[model samples]
Target: MRLKSVLAILLISISATSCSLYNKLVYRIDVPQGNYLQAEQVAQLQNGMTPEQVQYLLGTPMLTDPYSSYTWYYVYLQQKGYEDPEQYTLTVNFNQKGTVSDFNLDRPLPQQQDADIKPLELENNKSWWQSMKDFFSFS
Candidate 1:
């Protein structure tokens, strides 16, 4: 019957529309796993820092082997919705006397750029009229 067909069509449309609406309305939270270390924190690390000092600055290591008591590992991972996870690792090796001997970092620590600071200082020092003149200047 036409009524039955119309009812079926209405149900299908409602279900289809509901599926799309559900996707739009639902929020997916980002899942962050493991330790997060900052560049400044890593920069604080020195070759001769004691285990306690390192631990104080960087917190406890995420992974440490039972057999390798002198080796400490700091790991960080951040995962967000549909994006590649960010990861970094730092490894510290202590000598027999318990002083930090050497270390390795998966990524280089970010350095403060003088060029970036210089531009901001220059911009702040310039007057509004000077900025406008500079903007319109051919050179």
Candidate 2:
């Protein structure tokens, strides 16, 4: 009876303390914004294409310069909580004739998959046999 009471008190105190400890337990989702694009879409762009054609190919520009109507900006920003921000920019400029003149796609850092890097393993990945054993075990 005494052991049960001590165990109960200890568990309650530990849980109560853990709930108010450091705020690291909170989960943060990856924040992504702006027009998402693929390599094929960017490659399909051709010179002398009208704004309507460009829009059809690559959706609408995320930001259009208020001062200059001829310029279009396609920006992509992704923030992973535990990793450095991944981003890219695509700027399309049109001449006075109002057609696709020239554009730039700038990638400061290579794409995440370009490198053979793997994400952090927060929990152990057990094999099928081990998982079955664990499921059958009471403790």
Candidate 3:
């Protein structure tokens, strides 16, 4: 009976550990290769350029903001199956006159990076708890 109880506890522990490990293996939409555009290229796009012209230069946007067609979003993200992924986001907003009003390029979407790991300057800064938790946790 003692042996059976120990075995049961061990099994439970293993199952819990497995569950945590599986949680760490995050999967994401793979960003295609050789498609990053230069900032200069984006800047060359003047206001009053039609959607077709924009698409010709930058390809289709990942999404358009719901509020207006004036806002365009292009995004890229990459992750190793187990290692954390890196992200990049680009946003272009046009003015009422249909000219480029503002633009932004950012490290991947916040939600994507914010998942599993918080941003830090150094890998060493990652807490032992977070590291172990991440290493063991699978997606």
| Candidate 2 lDDT score relative to the true structure | 0.84
Q: Give per-residue CA lDDT, model 3, range 8-88, as digits (tens).
A: 999999999999888766564544432355556666777567667777888888878997898998876666455565656
* C-alpha lDDT score of every prediction, in listed order: 0.83, 0.84, 0.72
Candidate 3: segments with Cα more than 4 A from true spot? 15-53, 108-139
Per-residue lDDT of model 2, residues 50-114, tens digit only: 99999999999999999999999999888876567778889999999999999899974343474
Candidate 2: stretches off by over 4 Å:
1-25, 108-139
Number of clashes recorded per candidate:
0, 0, 15
Clashing pairs in 2: none
Q: CA RMSD for every model?
A: 7.6, 12.7, 15.8
**After superposing candidate 1, which stretches have Cα over 4 Å from the reference?**
1-26, 108-139
Best by lDDT: 2
Better of 2 and 3 by TM-score: 2
